[model samples]
Target: MILSVPLSLGGLIATAPSARAVPSMARQTGYECSKCHTVFPELTPYGRRFKLGAFADSSEKWDERPWTQRLPFSAALQGSRTSTSDTAAGGTGSSDFPQNDKTILQTAAIYYGGKIMDNAGALVQYNYDGIEKRWGVEMFDARYANGVTVAGREMTYGVTLNNSPTVSDIYNSTPAWGFPHTGSAATQMPAASIVDMTLASKVSGVGVYGMWDDLLYFELANYRTAKTGFFRFMALGQSWNSDELAGSVVEGNSPYWRLALQKEWGPHSVAVGTYGLVSRLKQDANVPSLGANRYRDIAYDLNYQFISGEHSASSRLTWINERQRRNNAVISEGLASNSINTLKTLRIDAHYYFRRQWGGGVQYFRTTGSTDELLYNTGDSLMGSTNGSPNTKGWIAEINYLPVTNVKLALRYTWFQQFNGASTDYVPGRNASDNNSLFLMGWVLF
Candidate 1:
């Protein structure tokens, strides 16, 4: 018998102050982080001027190729199209005849980053799914740092559980070159069915991060898996039997947290933050009315960036609070129970860049919730009444192009609408005012 795994030393002691305040753009500009991260998990400004020139390096000037043995690769390509009048049954049904509105090839990814020592570094990703032919592992990051000891003590650190970030198109505001690449009824929730609303390529856990200087940034995590699973009749389409999902078991402890504050004065840069997640669940004697669930979410975001030269602009806003609870339920034949669920969201995004390889953007989202007051019961004959109203809205528009500088091309359009003023014709014969639809996409990066 041999099985042992345990190595997280608080995410390797928080990667030593951003690895001793940045050095090695391969030691100055020998480049990596994909020469500005189209996706090494997103970042650009020549990767933020190789991270603000590794936090203001003495005065700049270091490119003589320090550790050059070579290794860094990247690639991406995408496509899309959609215009609709709403139609549904099993899947891939609307697009209103005409061979379903055309245009495809969604996502393709390939990545690699460098440095094995001299402090440590790594970033790897591989994804290819031409409509699910499969090829996974979307992320991996490893870091370490320790330098600068007196003078206000500068520090940086790291430890990652891959899959990184918030995942829904990376920190909400949607549109990462969109389409039906998952809609946003205020960040996913159309009574949530369709496999509990996709997107969340991965999340495994193990974080211990830090940053001190640009005004503090922090993280402390635990996560232990969550690709997505939290069911409770998903509005009412029923299908949750695998002993009732949610964390599937491995004991407990699932905390996650984050905090941030950033600064830059010249061209103006700002950041504000908060992050969250807390979970616990267990108990299912063959789902005896099922219970024992607890979940939480909290968020806050603000960003601003504008640089002249070729021109650039960015603006963002996000706020969310999601909660869930169940605590031991059996409720009848023997009695035992509890319940509560909640959701609230708001998002806004905008971007603009010209001549530095064309660009455009826009996004808006809103959500409201509260329903399921015992959605159904038939002890007396037929008692099925559940209606809680809270509207939902979504919108997106985008365009991008960069012929070279590590290739990029994009186009996107999306719209979704939901109103619970209670109306049902159940689509058996059509026209209940046909809901709404329109999604389009196209992308390529390398």
Candidate 2:
């Protein structure tokens, strides 16, 4: 039984901060990267505010001329090498490509992003996957924000048009922008949940979000199924697959909700937040479904950062529990033993930056859930389950060195404790350790 992951984008068991004056926001505001990011993506206090404002703030003279005049365009290139403990079982595309072969041009992307008007800003990406040999709409967001007062408290409210739920978020601590920034598209992981693993590029979403008193944040949004043709609108090209889409095919509209509270004083800042979504989805797009398979996923997150002098430190933790009602799958497909199931995922990471040049971080991830024999009963095949289980755990450690303000070099190693639900006898003859991997990559944004 093959289940479709809801998001076209996944944590990828795989897998740029703009540094310096990114010509985009920096040129528009005359502010340097240090004013917004300690390292790209990782935000400073002011950076968060800038994002909350929809990247529309500027201290420089407003050029009434078309932004096309300034040409705030940029591109990113990634080169990486992947090494596994054991040779992979040949499958599709580069899934079985040589591991220690010459470095691959993992990915390439171009963007036309940044403020379009005083109250509007956009960040759109066009990506080309070298391994899959495909073009895709990586991420797209267009926002309209304004300053307002809600009940006597300072507030910033905005309406966002985006391709995914968390892609419009101000903080990078959430699942969509979590650590491991980039991973080998070739790496494989065990069974996954709809919320944590998928749900990035498969659907379209629009929501209203805002922050009040610099302590409270809330958002309300809805998502619907999207097709490959939509990418042409952003000039991001097309989808990787022509058959069925990579994200959940929803019925009607799916509701998404998020809330957070934060505090800051001196050089320390901390925040706690909750986000969830209720989706009614189906597996096959070609065939009609008996009924919608329902998934209600709820999550909690915590982020803490402290910056003082030349030293900076930060930590992020997120946990999600997804409740599944498999009535449709059981009645129509007979692929599940139980009418209900549950899946859970937890991730934690910490990073330290020395003098804003060298950085190191460690991350741990775990996934577990109740299983149905039909869903987790098979062998060592790519989609098989050695045992009737959906469980996996691993550790990732990485180090980074900035060769320049806009470029970074990184090395990461991942060790597996359990794969496909077990450590030993995980399959007929293989051990989980065989999946351990090492990845080295170079990332840049300008």
Candidate 3:
């Protein structure tokens, strides 16, 4: 069975921080990358505040001039090798794990980030996926921010326009900036929460947010599928498959909301937050008259960081639960076993770095959901779930070394304990461990 939701946006497995670690951001603030990052893309408290302020704060008076003078541009390149425990049976070069045991250029990307005006700023990105062999805009965020006093307390508020739901968030605990920051594009992970980068680069959003007394943060936003000419232009001519579009059509706009509380004392910082998305989509893009399917995804998360002298460490936890109302998926689409089903995802990660030069981290992840044979029971060995269950659990361990502030090398390994429905013979003869992988990478930014 094939189920397409209007904002499916392909798999989120390959999503990375296009705007994070941009050298231009460091130049703009007159600070080293360490000022904003504990590790390259992970933000420090000051980094979060910089983003919350719309990236407008600057150290140079010349920032008031035209952006061209500042040369607010940066680029990134990546190369990696992937090795899976077992290649799919009968698999060839074009099959699953195409680059298994092979090294290849993984990505090439260009970024633009700076203050558009005194009160406005934006981060835009366009990149090439070496594995998919495609070039398109994958990240864009424009904002206007200002500060005000409310009840004698400092309040920072802003308006944001961007692609991707959590792209504008200041926390790395969310999907957009979550752990396992980088992964092999040639490898595929099964099962993900609908709210976890599922709609990234596939939709456009507008939001308003405020941070009061540096204590509470709240945001409200709405998103719509980017399928039309104008919206597609906003997405920088990203292409969509005709059949894929015809399979799942967005009915209308979806609402996304966020709330968080943060506190910092000396060298310790902590945050707790909740966010959600509600979407209504046409069950069949070909048969809009069939009505729509409703998806409600809610998540709770926690973030903590410790920084002192040459040591820095952070930890994150995120749990998501999605309630599905298969209005037409059951009868009209025949893609679900029940009218209502619930899916849940949990992730926990932590890492420590010394002088921003060396570090290692680990992540524990799992996903479980209601069984629906019609939707998940495909006989395909590699991507199938013989038992019609959506249950998967895994652990990832990684070690990193930075030769310089702009260059990094990493070795990471993923171990799967459960996949699809089982650890042993999830399919006819393949065990989940068969998909375990080791990835080595080199990433450079300038």
lDDT of 2 by residue, 102-171 (tens): 5888778877666777888877777777665678776778889998888998899999887776767666
C-alpha lDDT (0 to 100) for residue 95 of candidate 3: 72
Each prediction's TM-score versus the true structure: 0.27, 0.90, 0.93
The candidate maximizing lDDT is 3
**Which order, best to worst by TM-score?**
3, 2, 1
| Order by lDDT, highest first | 3, 2, 1
Q: After best superposition, candidate 1 residue 260: deviation in angstroms?
A: 34
TM-score of 3: 0.93
Cα displacement (angstroms), candidate 3, residue 439, comes to 1.1
Worst 10 residues of 1 by lDDT: 1-10
**TM-score of candidate 2 versus the correct structure, residues matched by position:** 0.90
Instruction: List clash counts for every candidate, in order.
Output: 16, 6, 0
Q: What tens-digit string does per-residue lDDT give for candidate 3 at 124-181?
A: 8888877767787778889999999999999999999988888889998787878777
- Model 1 ranges with Cα > 4 A deviation: 1-29, 32-140, 143-160, 163-357, 361-393, 398-416, 419-446
Error of 2 at 216 (Å): 0.2
